[model samples]
Target chain A: TQLLEQSPQFLSIQEGENLTVYCNSSSVFSSLQWYRQEPGEGPVLLVTVVTGGEVKKLKRLTFQFGDARKDSSLHITAAQPGDTGLYLCAGVSLGNQGGKLIFGQGTELSVKP
Target chain B: IAGITQAPTSQILAAGRRMTLRCTQDMRHNAMYWYRQDLGLGLRLIHYSNTAGTTGKGEVPDGYSVSRANTDDFPLTLASAVPSQTSVYFCASKASAGYSYNEQFFGPGTRLTVL
Candidate 1:
């Protein structure tokens, strides 16, 4: 079974602080996606990285996919209170059909102003 | 478009009772999925249907069942609820027109508590 392990399960930071969340796995994936979920809401797609060493940016967020396709990372620059939420990384395995995803245990971020 | 909607925003049930969570999508997505979210577990897929009339079991399918009678709805049923089954349930759908990066649109989620 493939599993994605995420680091720093919980983070509490002051406004304008930079933080990075990591997701690692031994199995390779075809693509990786980042999602942000607020309380009582389902996760919303942030970005999708399909190539090895790919980097995608969305405003204050930067997402990187590992060259081996076995890991990924999300970095938040100058995080504010609005950035506080649960971040999740999910991957689509090679040759998998129907867009099935293997999700990592989320990283809960709390940004205080 | 209404996207996806789930019924019974929150529910509380006895341990031995049966429960069904309803999900409907107006986007006409070809693939629909059911996932359960718990603390420290993120979201684990319980079941999925690639299209109407076909369904597949997911990682944590031991205690849940799902059915897709049409293109718009996928409902999940728990035959006998257990305490460990208490979790928030989310329904998601994805279109299969081209090479998909697995961009699934999700519902607001249903909070279920088994007492």
Candidate 2:
């Protein structure tokens, strides 16, 4: 089983602050995805990075895959109340069972205005 | 679009009782998944179905069972509920086109409490 560990289990910051959440694992993965979930709702996918050293940007959010494909990071610029939620990272490998995802512990972020 | 719907949005059951969580998707996704989310454990996969008539065990499948009779529905059953099984359960499905890369659409989730 692959284990992904996320740092800063709980984070609280004022609006407009910048924050970065990290997801690290010892096992190599073919793809990594980031998801944000609000209270009482299922998680929504934010981004998926398939290649090492790949970076994708959506609005003010930037997602980076580690050079070794064993880690990933999510950076939020000028955080807003809307960005507050539980952020999770999931890793997927290649094979017939490739679609299955291994998730991290998740980081809860609180952005207060 | 009613991408996915789960019955009994929330349920409370006594220990040793039987319960089945229903999951249905309208997109006709070929693959469906069941997962449980705990306070500190993020989301753990319980069971998954690649297509109709086929199923596979996930990371935490000891206490859960699933069946897929068709492409649109996948239900999870707990034979004997325990307090340790209490958690928010989520149902998800992905289309065959993006099975390798795209994200899976998720249901609203079912909150289950076992006493």
Candidate 3:
């Protein structure tokens, strides 16, 4: 059984401040995906990182996959009130078929105006 | 495109009752999945269908069953609902046409409570 551990389950930051969320695991993965979910809604994909040590950016968000493929991180720049929501990290195990995904506990970010 | 839609936005039923959650997708994706989201457990896959006439078990499939008789729908069934089964259910679908699988598109989710 593979498990992904996410740090700082809860975060409250003021608008304009930068913050980072981390996801760590001992098992290697073929790909990692970040998702943002607002209240009462299912999660929506933010980014997908497939290579070790690779980084991808989406507007004010940056995502990085660890060299070992066992860790990943999400960094938000100049956070805004609209960014408040739950952030989730999901990893796809190597050689797994049908695109199965393993998810982390999630980070609840509350960006205050 | 109504990417995906789930029936009965919210349901509350007495323990031991049978319940079936309906999920329909419009994208004609080859893969469909069912998951349950708990307060701290994140999303745990209950079942998945790679395509029509094929289904597989996921991490938490102890008390649930799923069927995929066609390409557009996957339904999850609980023979006898238990309180512990109360959680938000999400259905997701993605196309599988190339080497890399696509990110899943999720439905709004259905909230179920068994008392």
Candidate 4:
């Protein structure tokens, strides 16, 4: 089974601070996706990185995929209170049944005003 | 647009009881999935259906069963409920026209507690 491990299981920071979350795996994936989930709600897709060494930016958030396709990272610049939530990383492998995703434990971010 | 709707927003049941979680999507997405979220575990897939009339097991398929009779409804059944099965269940659907990069939209989720 392919497993994705996220570092810094929990993080608390003040608004305007910068933080980065890391997701690492030993198995290579065809694509990796990042999601943000709030309490009482399912995850919402934030971004998907498909190519090795690819980088995608969405306003203050930036995502990068490892050159080996075995890891990914999410960096939030000048994070705000609205960015506080659970961030998850999921990997899609080739020939996966129905394109099943292997997810990381997640990083719980708490931003204080 | 009511992307997805899950029945019985929350349910509490006794151990050894049988329960089914109903999920439906109106987007006509070809792929539907069932996942359970627990503290510290994030989310784990229980079952998935690429299309109607087909079902496949996911990372944590034990104690769970699913069926896809048509394009919109996919229900997950638990033959015997256990405390270990208590968690938030989420139903998601995605259009398959795109490659592996398709986005998945999720429902509000169902919170189930087994006593």
Go through the candidates in order and give the C-alpha RMSD of each one to the true structure: 1.2, 1.3, 1.2, 1.2
* Candidate 3: fraction of native contacts reproduced: 0.49
Which parts of model 1 are misplaced by more than 4 Å?
B97-100
TM-score of each: 0.97, 0.97, 0.97, 0.97
Model 4 stretches with alpha carbons more than 4 Å out: none
List, residue by residue over A1-113, the lDDT tens digit for candidate 1. 88999998999999999999999999999999999999989999999999999999999999999999999999999999999999999998887776799999999999998
lDDT of 1 by residue, B1-115 (tens): 5899999999999999999999999998989999999999889999999999999999999989998999999999999999999999999999862345958999999999999
For model 3, the DockQ equals 0.61
lDDT of 1 at B72: 97
Clash pairs, model 4 backbone: none
- Clash counts per candidate, in order, are 0, 0, 0, 0
TM-score for candidate 3, please give it: 0.97
The CAPRI quality class of candidate 3 comes to medium
Error of 1 at A111 (Å): 0.5
- Best candidate per lDDT, number? 1
Q: On residues A17-63, what C-alpha lDDT tens digit does candidate 2 reach at each position?
A: 99999999998888999999999999999999999999999999999
**Predicted candidate 4 versus true structure: per-residue lDDT over B80-110, tens digit per residue:** 9999999999999998723578898899999
lDDT of 1 at A111: 95
**Tens-digit per-residue lDDT, B1-115, candidate 2:** 5699998899999999999999999998888999999988999999988888989899899988999999999999999999999999999998862355768888999999999
